[model samples]
Target: MSNISIIGLGGVARAIGARAIEGGNAVEVIGRDAAKAKDLAAALGGGATAGTFGATPVGDLVVLAVPYAGAVPVIAQYGDALAGKVVIDVSNTSNADATGLVTPDGTSGAQEIAKAVPASAHVVKAFNTVFGHILAQGGPLDVLFAGDDARAKASVSAFIESLGLRPLDAGGLEVARWLEGTGLLMISLARHGVGNFNFSLGVDLPG
Candidate 1:
């Protein structure tokens, strides 16, 4: 089982922590509000614990479950504490209205976050496409991910599998921009095409 440190206290973070714990992975919940972190850890149970904010997380895999805007700043706060760890960026760069991406034409939120993290840490973009409630339900859903480091991607893929999901590698860090776009598209489809958020994006290979 993997040791995971989730760096947020929001719904997404809670859902991931729950699934990670259910998957038999040890979890450490970290947040600016220590009380909320403790509360979330207690809620998740299964040996999940609260981690001190801005401190070096005890887990090898760190999930950055914060908003896109706060991702880089949060990484900056962690500094070298995250060195040599596999950092997962589960944020989308969509604007406030979800109509467009907030990042520039060439970069993604994951890419920007990579810039802020220590050189020893590897950033992998993932989980931005799935809704928190749907993910919390626990199903064999498809999780698309992108990163530059092969070993880091493999580790993240294994973690995804442990959570009872399929992991599709969508190439390197450059592909993260398109993944963010796909996340915005999912939002658009949910509001206009699908008319609801009950669905998830996936692939069906020919057998």
Candidate 2:
């Protein structure tokens, strides 16, 4: 990936942006609060930027790091500008489970993002479950990514690998629903004290 645009300057975006900068990619960070974006960009120190969501330049890949509800409106604002771009959905739907905790649902934030963006946009689901605290370590984790477009999926997989994270292709756009749900189900673990946000999904198939 040559350039990466991160939409949202939250903790998640910050972690991912820092990793992107470390990888030598020119990063543009867009957020509602200009001060926060500038602060983050300054910290990144590798051609990072602060701007409105619409001002984000066209890049090899774009990462949506905002809440679920925020994704649709941002897509609308971008319009045709997002055509042919690879979009990664790294947000959860904020739902919970049987115990008053975030429940993972069948339809996820990724699916919703695909619907919101133009058909020309290759939207991939990823980064939703990784916590900011763990992400900053620049270590690898079992990351599940879903997209209908093979080229786009491959591109995102490469970016994930750059962060030292393992990539798992979860089939197509629909698989995003399950991935989103998994993130929500994780919330229950934290609520019940069975696990904190540190809970992560790891797959170890019998070889």
Candidate 3:
């Protein structure tokens, strides 16, 4: 069983943790609010535990499932406790209010997260482009992400595959600029009421 610690208790975190437990992984759901953490953990069931900020530093995969602005602070909060662990950044850095990417001069959200955490930890971008609704509903869902570390990427890809989803390796963390932007586009498309295009797409290759 994989030791998974999700560093947020929200819709996205719930969706991901639920799926991970279904895949036979041990999941610890964390939150600043302890009561909320217990509620969320109870919802997850089967040996899943609710965690406070003081929980043990024991996840094989640490999922950063908070907002874009909270990424670095979360890393700082975890501090030396997370050294040598793999971080799965599922936070989208796009400004939902402004409907645009929020990082500095062409830097992507996950890339920013990588900068914040200690070098001892490996960071991989995953599950940011997809909405929480689709993940909970279980689609032929598509998870798009990038990372500099090959082993880190492989580990996250395995988790995604275990959930019966497609993992699209969009190259190095530099590609996060595009990945982050796509979240805005996805919301716009859904708001525009283009049913078929809402959270779904296809690509054609010329022979």
Clashes of each: 0, 8, 0
lDDT of 2 by residue, 1-207 (tens): 557888888889989988888877778888878888899889888888876768635577999888776788988888877887899988877643333223235556676677777778889999876767778776668888899999999999888877778889989988877777677666777767665676566678797
Tens-digit lDDT track of model 1 for 56-132: 99999999999988888899999999999999999989999999999999999999999999999999999998988
Report the lDDT tens digits of candidate 3 across residue range 9-28. Answer: 98999999999988888899
Q: What TM-score would you give candidate 3 relative to the actual structure? A: 0.91
Best by TM-score: 1
Q: List the residue pairs that clash in candidate 1.
A: none
True-vs-predicted CA distance for residue 138, candidate 3, Å: 1.4
Q: For each candidate in turn, give its C-alpha RMSD to the true structure in angstroms.
A: 0.6, 2.6, 2.3
* TM-score against truth, every candidate: 0.99, 0.88, 0.91
Q: Superposing every Cα of model 1 onto the true structure, what RMSD results?
A: 0.6
Q: Compute the lDDT of residue 146 as modeled in candidate 1.
A: 97
Best by lDDT: 1
Steric clash pairs (candidate 3):
none
Ranked by lDDT, the better of candidates 1 and 3 is: 1
Ordered from best to worst lDDT, the candidate numbers read: 1, 3, 2
Cα-based lDDT at residue 90, candidate 2: 89
State the C-alpha lDDT per candidate: 0.94, 0.79, 0.81
